[model samples]
Target: MTMFSTIRLRAAAVLASFALALSGCFLSPGKFTSELVFTGPDSFTFSYEGEIFFLGLSKLAQMDAAQAEFTPPECYNQETYESQECSAEELADARANWESGAADRAAEAKKKAEQMAAMMGGIDPSDPKAAEELVKRLKRQKGWERVVHKGDGVFDVSYRVTGTMGHDFMFPLIEGFPATNPFVQTFVRQGGQVRINAPGFATQNPEQAGMGAMMGIGSLAGLAAMRAELDGQGDAMPGIPVIDGTFTVRTTRGMRVLANNTDEGPEPNNTGEALTWRITTRTAQAPTALIALIP
Candidate 1:
């Protein structure tokens, strides 16, 4: 019974949590080139030129509902570990557990949806108007040079920012969004240590991506089933974009990189050292670097 109660939406969580785990739940990158440069310990410049994909209205509108609804685990399945030859009492107990959990699931879903709505200007990405509002909201910000909706929740845009690393930094820091899951995260630690990660760039690694790699979809059948289970139909939704891009980081001399996953590591650049990662649908880990500056 302990295991049965927690199995709600196990396989489906992969698809649903793909974007949901992103925490932002609104925007993720499709294809782009992003870069971060440190002129000095307290100074930096960052830019991203690429596509921002919206998965809520376009690819995963049923995610919340899918998460909320529990499909009964079939016992005696050959492929899955969920079920086996069950006695009548076990079956009855499972049914009772399922029935009891329904109200809990519904309540949790409602609470989560409400919290997301509060953060997102009272609108979730599943709404058609979300795309327009996103563009407008981004345009109102100083860094967003272009914000054009290309249909199906994809946007073509350019962004650039220059600031001091005296404090931490993050990209796609929407005014009304969650801060925990920035596409780009920069943390300034004590003793001039700096850490960075591009959570949105990695497309296909399970460690980084909850769904298909990063935010890339793994299976249409899975999507259809989750959607059908929640939206009452299993038809596939189209126009899901691929993820492809390059990320580069340049640091001035005297900076020592502590950890990273770049080909050939950090190569000598005009300013100092540079790290680069090419992103694709097969790309699993995004760009990450921890550097110690001359203090």
Candidate 2:
């Protein structure tokens, strides 16, 4: 449900991370309630019941058709490093150059989209039945309990995934879709430790932000370059639906919750403690935690 700078429609895919700026983009969240509950050191249950927005099927993909008013290119002095007024001839040349490349850019964008479509279960975004095909694919999967195409790349659905933490895990993972940046994650570590980070659910996660900086993806707007386009709650992008929800992490007693950003920290439950994050459009830091699981 998001992308990158100026979002050259050609490269955006969920049909764009498993919705990265690359070919396998991940879906953006709409309104919903989700939770991650840890019953034991080696097991967990994660469920997402809400709306997921697909970029290829949304107004975003049509951005190419929305041409902007051309602005005269500025001329700068190379030697003195100062701004200079452009000659009428220079302006004409610039306009001519940009106009000449419009068709090429549009074509490249379409080709990129088609390439993405091939990996996205082979259903073209241009096809009227694309959304229905997507629904069928999700229905055929194991965790996608319900999927309803609401048109324009949006779907109302319920998804639940559970498994032992012997290995890493990702959510909203389709049968044939290549894995990109996931909406949620649970990674098992060396000493019965587990990590939880949901970049898609948040505007930005602190650790990933630092990593993004190191990787040259400096958008504080979120996890990757594409997240800036989605902006989690869609504050930066107005047309997209609001991303509002709750992520509750419940763990068994004695499980050490080492790190988190919950408003009041973890709360007590019958067997253990509960950590809750009240996600909103303005959620600056993505929800995260490091818990050393109890054996």
Tell me, by TM-score, which candidate is best. Answer: 2
lDDT of 1 at 105: 66
Please, what are the lDDT tens digits per residue for candidate 1 over residues 1-295?
2233222443455445543433544456677899998989789989999887655545454454664544445555444545566667766787788779888767866666665566566567656687788788889988899989888767899999899988988888877666644678899999999999877665443434344433332222223223333443433434545666788889998898889988789898767999898876565556788998774
Compose the digit string of candidate 2's lDDT tens values, residues 1-295: 1112333231232222222343444356777899898878888888999888766676656555444445576575666646678778878887888798888767867775776586575778778887888889899888899898776677999998788989998876876667664677888989899999877676644344443232111111232334444554353432445577888888998798899877898888788988888766567666788888965
Tell me the spans in candidate 1 whose CA falls farther than 4 Å from its real position. 1-26, 62-116, 124-128, 203-237
- Single out the weakest 10-residue window by summed lDDT for candidate 2: 212-221
Q: What root-mean-square deviation over C-alphas does model 1 reach? A: 7.5
Worst 10 residues of 1 by lDDT: 216-225
